[model samples]
Target: MKLLSFRVKKSHLLLVGILLVAANLRAPFTSLAPLLDAIRLDFSLSAVQAGLIQTLPLLAFALFSPLAGSIAVKYGIERVIFAALLLIAAGIGYRSYGGLFGVYGGTVLIGLGIAMGNVLLPSLLKRDFPQRVASMTGLYALIMGVGAALGSAAVVPLSQLSALGWNGALFAMLLFPLLAMAIWFPQLSHGAARLAIAGEPQQRSGSVWRAALAWQVTLFLGLNSLIYYVVVAWLPSILRYQGFSAEQAGSLHGVLQLATAVPGLFTGHLLARMKDQRAIAVTVSLLAAAGLLGLLALPAFATLWVVLFGIGAGSTIILGLAFIGLRSGTPAQAAALSGMAQCVGYLLAVGGPPGVGLLYDATHSWHGPLLICAALALVMALVGYLAGRDRCLTPAEPLNEGRLSEEER
Candidate 1:
């Protein structure tokens, strides 16, 4: 009984550590946007060039995510996660000191770090909390929202500290990863015993790609991410163009990020109780659509539109994660499904910000880009409905031995 209790205590501590690490993944990336104008002025970059800087990490996410699964397979998730955090620290430190090349290189590293965590966290959650996937996903999303909000909110103030400068602002982000590392180091000490064994019995085949249900989940997550990051990269600038001060715009962006936590905390409960997740998905997407439309029609009301957008976008994010767990039969299956979804989904997602910027550059107006995103959100709604159904990926069966023997003979 004492040994069993000790095991339980250890498991709880590991879960806490994993979540802490997950929470730090996005803070560094998101925090930089609020201070982009200051950096651009200091560096003298064009709007398109600045957009490229903002887009680099996400592009890394698209490129690096597939590698995460293979890495986790070989190195153990806990070790990879710790290594990713250290890489993030190094990336941020480098960017804080280096010139333009350093900035871009550091950004790429941060993206790589985040991509590893993004791929591993869902799998870790599935492995650790099989029965509570939805709830745990909700918690993950909630903490992510908190991290994003804190990072976004702090950048302006941190940048103001004369001793720290913009470099200080970037370096300030190292604290979270450092804290998470301190918590995670003990799990690493446990060695292979703490790791999920490769080729375990639970790692069975499920025809995820062939399943329509799997596609739906992937599409929904992809679209949600595309829309979410587009806003993250551009919303402050968008609001500023619409007559708000840079400070006000940044604050509003932070608020929108904080609001993300609300739906994340509740969406899982709503989905678990309700038979249909489609309605919630559609509702959230439409809410986002409405916010975008409002921004187009009433740019002066940026704050109000952002609130609606946040609610819509946040709810969809929570629901998309819930579907990952709901659609898979086992933890390994969920991990495989998540890996497949994020791999394809982020590849599709990487296009959003740059594509929007290209359209803006071509048209010389936000109207065209806004319209395109709105339409995408509507399509996301339709796809989300199809994906959120209560179904799992079905595996193929082997042919009969008698028929195979006759053919071979």
Candidate 2:
């Protein structure tokens, strides 16, 4: 009984820690999207060049995510996450306070920091909260969504309505990540990420890279990322093009991000109870499609459309992250799968903002790019079906290998 109590207390502590880490993930990036035009005007950059600011992080994610697992193995998950948060804090300050070089370089550093956390968080959950992966993932998404909502909603007002200009607004936005960094500091003593010897030997990194399930989850996550980051980068501009005020546009972007948080509260309940995730996964994509289609067809209902997209984007994100845990047999495989998926997933997303920018440059229209995203949402429906399977990484390994539940084995 005493041991069980201690384990429960530790679980709660880890839950708090993981959620705190999740909050810093997207807020930093979304906070800047509303300010992209301001930065562009200040820097004298073209649309394509300005778009690179958004692309740089995704590029960093693709390049650095694969390395996070190995780094964690060497240094420990807690230590690596601490360092990642430091990079995030430092990057936020530098980007906000410095000039053009600081802008690009700081964003890159922030990306690298975030990439480590992103890859490790699911693996951490898989290792620690083996019984409730889906539920915990939902909570993770919920907190992350709230943080992003605050960033998107507040930054424009801070920059426009307060004493803080764009730089000050961004600089001030560093507080959340700084606090998260501080919170993570104590976790260093937990030791580095290590592999467990499950019933069957854990599949190596190459097995994960070669697995069809991993690839499916990768595409599911990648396409969803493509949809999300594109909207994050261009939604403000898209709203402006549709004749909304800058403040209105920024507020709606916040609304969209806030809407994203709503599904996180329930996604866990659904994923936990449902036999498979195909239904929710497919519905989520269609919701995004309908929302984007509404954007093209009906500009007057922008709020509703944004909400739909947000919910879809948010639920799919939760599912994708859940898949990383759900599909892997061991935490090590989880990290390997996460690294590979995010690397390619982000690579698939890295081109979106710039491609949309160039498309807009060519046609002076947001319609084309939005339509393309809507079509991809359909593709996500199919990918969701495959990724939502009830299988594990090792076909014969019981789903309870980490927890070692005999019934499951």
Candidate 3:
């Protein structure tokens, strides 16, 4: 009885630790946009250069994500996660205090850490709680959304603190990862045993890369991400152009982020009940399209537009993460698919903000860029519908000697 009780307690603690880790993943990056102008002024950076700060992280995700699964295969997922948390903490410290080198170098560290966490978390969840993938994914998404919203919401206030300023504001975010690390430390001791219990299959399949459904999932994730980062990078500027104050714009940005999280509360149940997720996908895309249309046609209703867009963007992310698990038959495959999707997905996303800027620069108006994004939302609806289909990426057969096929690689 004591042993069973102890196991239950440990399970609860592990769940809490996973959620805490999720919370740390996004806040550090999302928190920065509100402070971008301040950082720019302090650093004497051009708009392109300031934009680079945002893009750099995505680039790191693109570069590092494909490698994350292999690293986990060799090092064990728990150790990789622990290393990632340390990297994030160290990166935050460097970025906030290290001057020019700190800015770029720290961003690289933070981005790589986030990329590893992002790739590993889905696999970890799928491995430990096979029956609860959607529920757990939704919970993680909900926490992540809250964390991002909090990060965005807090930046202005933190920066405003007389003694702390921008540097201190960025530095303050370090606490999240530190806290997560503390919670996660206990899990590391049993990492090998945990992997064994999860039945890490020896048969590796190289088939994910060749699967059509995998591409659909990848595109769904990529397009959704592209729309999100584009908005993240430019929404404040758009609001400002419509005559809102900087503070108002920043607050709205935070609100937008918060709205994205609202769906997380319900997505798990929704996903679990409906394997064919096309309706949800189409609905969210339309909401986003309507929001973007509102921005162009009725700038006065900025609040409504942002709220709608946020819901659409946030729901898509939930679906994207859920798809990574729902479509895979094994945890390793989930990790491989996740790594592939994020690698290509983020690579596609790296151009978004800069592209938005170039379009705005060329036309000298928000109308052109807004229209393009609205149309892309429609495209997302189409692609997401395809990805929403219930199917696995490959047959459930394990590969001989647990080796991935050269073609799949």
For candidate 2, write residues 190-253 as lDDT tens digits: 6632322211233355467667778888899999998998897789999999999999997888
The per-residue C-alpha lDDT of model 3 at residue 208 equals: 69
Summed backbone clashes in each candidate are: 0, 1, 4
> In terms of TM-score, which candidate is stronger, 1 or 3?
3
> Residue-wise lDDT of candidate 1 within 89-191, one digit each (tens)?
8888888888888788898888889888887787777777777777778877888878877887787898999988888988888888898999899888754
Alpha carbon RMSD to native, model 1 = 5.2
Q: Which candidate leads the pack in TM-score?
A: 3
Q: Which ranges of candidate 1 are over 4 A from the true structure?
A: 189-191, 194-207, 236-251, 274-276, 297-302, 395-409
List per-prediction Cα lDDT, in the order shown: 0.78, 0.84, 0.86
Compute the lDDT of residue 9 as modeled in candidate 1: 89
Question: Which has the better lDDT: candidate 1, or candidate 2?
Answer: 2
Our tally of clashes for model 1 stands at 0
Every model's Cα RMSD, please? 5.2, 4.7, 4.2
Q: Candidate 1, after superposition: displacement of residue 169 in Å?
A: 2.2
